[model samples]
Target: MAADDERGRGVLTAADRAYLRGDSEYGSVQAERNARARIRDRIYDALRDFELLVEGLDDRDLDLVFEKRVGEDDGTEAFDALVSTLAFLYRGVGRTDLDFETVLREGVNLAEASEDRGATVDFDVTYHALDADHLLSKLDDDESLSLTEIAYLYESADVTPDELAAYFEDARAPDIEDGRVQSNVTDY
Candidate 1:
């Protein structure tokens, strides 16, 4: 009777039910979903941070940098070299679609316009946001992102793995039903 009581008590738990059905794969699925969510959040946060940093730059500063001649006679090279380097780094990370030169040209134009009008220009972060959104969408679609790409995205966004770990430290395990898991993120 004691053994029967113990068995009954164990059977009442969800873990016991899953164990009984040999459905360990659901745990893996839940883990994968959580990891994807963390990566998505990191990417979003990084893009926002970059946007704020760019927006806060003074127009006067941009004008000075734009006017500064590098290597004796570069002919108004406003961040062209820096942009090219960044573009190269992004390409190394699998972002083949980004043309840093185009972004630099547009930024220089805006800076020039702002300087001419004696007004601060707002930096446009639409492209960066779109890129981050695309990455999130790819994650949602179960597309396999390369490790190098992931590393670069995190580095560009200035998101640290420690930060992500801290953010999800208090997260609870998701509930599973019929091999489908309901996230704990929505529970709050």
Candidate 2:
């Protein structure tokens, strides 16, 4: 929709559909498949916009759930949409057998895709707990940290909320102002 270029069959607005041909005429962009994708993109964008602005007038509508926490007042509400989204994305992106939490938080590395048939890719992702000491130790001052230690750190850690908040206790930190970053991180 941005006025950036005059190429690529332009936008396929619904109003312009009347001029569309019944016979499959390939576009210069590529072939019939490429043209079909472009047209589909146009239709989906229009419908998505319409739903977002016009279809949510009723707050109690069950079909319009967008967040995983909805209907959880009693704590047993299902997270179907969340589960489906994660499953579909992992499958499409060549990942299977991965848990939703892992995909949501750490994500997968796709570069090693050809390593194994079971895992579309091969990856040596290291999970770790991180603290300021761990990160500062990755630096190269004579106080320069050991590369092995840094590797070991990332291979197994996450920074606890309290530890990260303590960063600003030093008065000379980037996320200063009484550890505001720590406060926001805690909120998350």
Candidate 3:
């Protein structure tokens, strides 16, 4: 009876459950932080597993797998974004598909959900190979980088137009369309 009472005491009461469910501001913060941590951990695990699976596949097979898995509408947006980012990261040694952009976009989406949510995932370092040369060449070839991409590079990667210009000749800032400033683009 004593052991049983102790075990019951350890169990969460209704009020405890409600607190964990985020009934207060502090509870809400804690809950969101914990949830984001879980999601980030799952994303890392998924990426690691995906990397192992793709290691044995040729480019063609990898593309097929990526297309099939990411196209599944049953997945949440975050899941699709995670898989697509992994696919883009694996798409080349020196050649990367622009699909990696989804990771940062997803990060911003999460941040939009809660400002604190963005702090949980560091999207910049994941694609360290996506240097100024690649981005500049893409821009030169008439591909456009979104404002989110620019702000992410600027804020997280410390990549400014001047820095890129030092790497690639004639690198110029992408023109901001319609003079609209993104919340993240402070210097614009």
Which candidate gets the maximum lDDT versus the true structure?
3
Candidate 3 colliding pairs: none
Q: What is the TM-score of each predicted model, taking all chains together?
A: 0.24, 0.19, 0.25
The lDDT of each candidate is 0.45, 0.42, 0.48
Model 3 misplacement above 4 A: 1-27, 56-63, 66-188
Q: What digit string (tens of lDDT, one per residue) describes model 3 on residues 34-110? A: 75566557556765775465345566775565676445533444353575455545563235455444655764565
Worst 10 residues of 1 by lDDT: 176-185
lDDT per residue as tens, model 2, 24-53: 354565666676777778756754664454
Residue 137 Cα positional deviation in candidate 2, in Å, after optimal superposition: 86
Which TM-score value belongs to model 2? 0.19
User: What 10-residue stretch in candidate 3 is worst by lDDT?
Assistant: 175-184
Question: In lDDT terms, how accurate is model 1?
Answer: 0.45
Ranking of models by TM-score: 3, 1, 2
Model 3 alpha-carbon miss at residue 163, Å: 28
